[model samples]
Target: MALPNRLRRLLLGSDPRLARMLGYWAATCLLYFIGAALLILQVRAGAADHDSAVLLIGIGATGVAVFAVLVRASIVMGIAPSTLAAWQALFAIACNIGAYVVTGPLRGVYLIFLLVVLVFCTFSLRPRHTMLLCAYTLGILGATMVWLVATYPATYPAYVEGVHFASAACALISVTLLTGEMSKLRLRLKQQKEDLLAAMATIRKLATVDELTSLANRRHMNEVLVAQERRIDPAGQPTCLALIDLDFFKSVNDRYGHAAGDAVLRAFSAAARSELRAQDVLARWGGEEFLLLLPATTMTQAILVVERMAERVAAAPVAEISGGMRITFSAGLAQRHDREPFADTINRADKALYNAKSTGRNRISLG
Candidate 1:
């Protein structure tokens, strides 16, 4: 238990992603350990100098410590994680090249580290940066080979160095070029994933929202009713409901145009929404009809809310219509008691709406 908690704290401080980066570095550190062991073996066989090996290994160990400080500083300075990762790859490349320069007769084996660095860069950096790093690696390794031959012909011959440089160039260049294409493919797939997620969000809005009134449509209203029903059962509270219909709505479309009727509908929705509390939900049931839902409310409170809706609609005129027309609505109010299903309350409200229409056009009927 102690070990798990400590590990959790180390890996999941403020950023778990940074922990992942540290884990990647830990994995690569195994290569450093393996290279150190090989260096010791080369020293014992007299193929490499002990002092030069110790100096290079010391530098590599110090570079790892510097990497930790730089990463910590990057967080304080608000550096991006990807950019930090690129810096790590570059630092490792430098350390690997330094080792190759000092390793003498065992330099051929150390060249594998450069190939590993190229692979790491392909994932951590951009394709362009990866290509540049690959080119840089090839150039530096080639230069190191030429310098060793010129300075120490007894230990390093030009003919042998020429063949080694040729082989390293072909292998490193081939791997980098192939990995660059893979990097491009990865970027394209990532963009397509973002596009697909955005499309899904738009589709969800279309499914539950009325485009004309910009209000919650019937499907969404039903879901809201079910959710409210669940809360009411446990809380022992009443939920108020109102089914509203605009009086003489078809006449507005006939007298003016359908466009003007749309404007009137939009205006009514806006006015009613402004009169509602934050917890209240008002959705378009169909053409010129809306359902207003109030969670944890009594009949008296719900009636006041509906009254305010009526007053606001009367004051706000539809600009698209001639004479800046105002509208009136007939509403049927119902209250759902604790443990009562929403379907029963909604059915009663629908019947009461029919009564409001029969009695007079613009009044609220209680059921």
Candidate 2:
């Protein structure tokens, strides 16, 4: 058998934004570590000339690794505060600028780190924090470019001016594309949340409804009765309870089978439902049994209503079942009185129904 849906979601799935952020950060850190190690190795090959620089680069690489580990751990443990995430972003940008200064120029490869870091920040951080971090990153990148132009004029020689200009253009384009992608992700997440809520509401409604009869089931009737009781104005209105039991229902099921019995039940419910007024509530209480709650109705008024319902059920013929047999119901009606408990009223109605069933099966009895 397949795994349950919730288990699958828990074990094999992740939030899209978080997954993207994790991948971007993991790849970026790995690349930076590898690049830094290569640079240190090259300097070590010429250690006689660049001993101090080689040692410094190795230290910076180790620092980056350590910071990455700390941030990853905090996020995994759900302990990374928003303020700490902002500080981490600022620190990473500062370290990037420091690396460029140590190397005497800003290489295009540094842009890769900046772009990856920006994507990761957008995914991991909130909108306000991510934008603030983005601003800081742009500022640091600008400063690094200015430093390169001032300290290493030949690095951006005027003879190849277009190359330097084109790199800047590319950086702008990358930032634009990444921002649009983030916006799309946000929209998608919002839509997913709405869809989930709608599905849950539909499921809840279906739980309280009978599939075949389209009537309120037992559980739903109980809930509605309690809610109505709480809303009852003790001085202004009265609520009546009625128990309706279908007569000779088992005979129909025994003769025509369950499918035919279902059809007859549905037909009876539809006919009975048509006889009810807007202020009344009806539910399928159990097999061959139904309950009705009539608000602002007295015993006489409730009897008339129950009699009409009984007449409707008795008159309605269920075709394609039991030689098109006619169905009949017996109902017992009781009205709420001052100082009477709700449960007691229901018991009185039930007793009235028992009396009605004993006297004859196709009429309404009042208590």
- Model 2 RMSD vs true structure: 14.8
Quickly count the clashes in candidate 2: 0
Candidate that scores best on TM-score:
1
Candidate 1 clashing pairs, residues 3+ apart or interchain: none
Question: Which residue runs does candidate 2 get wrong by more than 4 Å?
Answer: 1-168, 232-235
| lDDT digits (tens) for residues 144-180 of candidate 1 | 8788889998888898888878888888888888888
Q: Write the per-residue lDDT of candidate 2 for residues 147-222, one digit (tens) a residue.
A: 6667767765543434644564477456746765785688689899999999998888788997778999888988
lDDT of 1 at 264: 89
Cα deviation at 91, candidate 1, in Å, is 1.5
What's each prediction's TM-score? Answer: 0.91, 0.54
Q: Least accurate stretch of 10 residues (summed lDDT) in model 1? A: 228-237
Whole-model alpha-carbon lDDT for candidate 1: 0.82
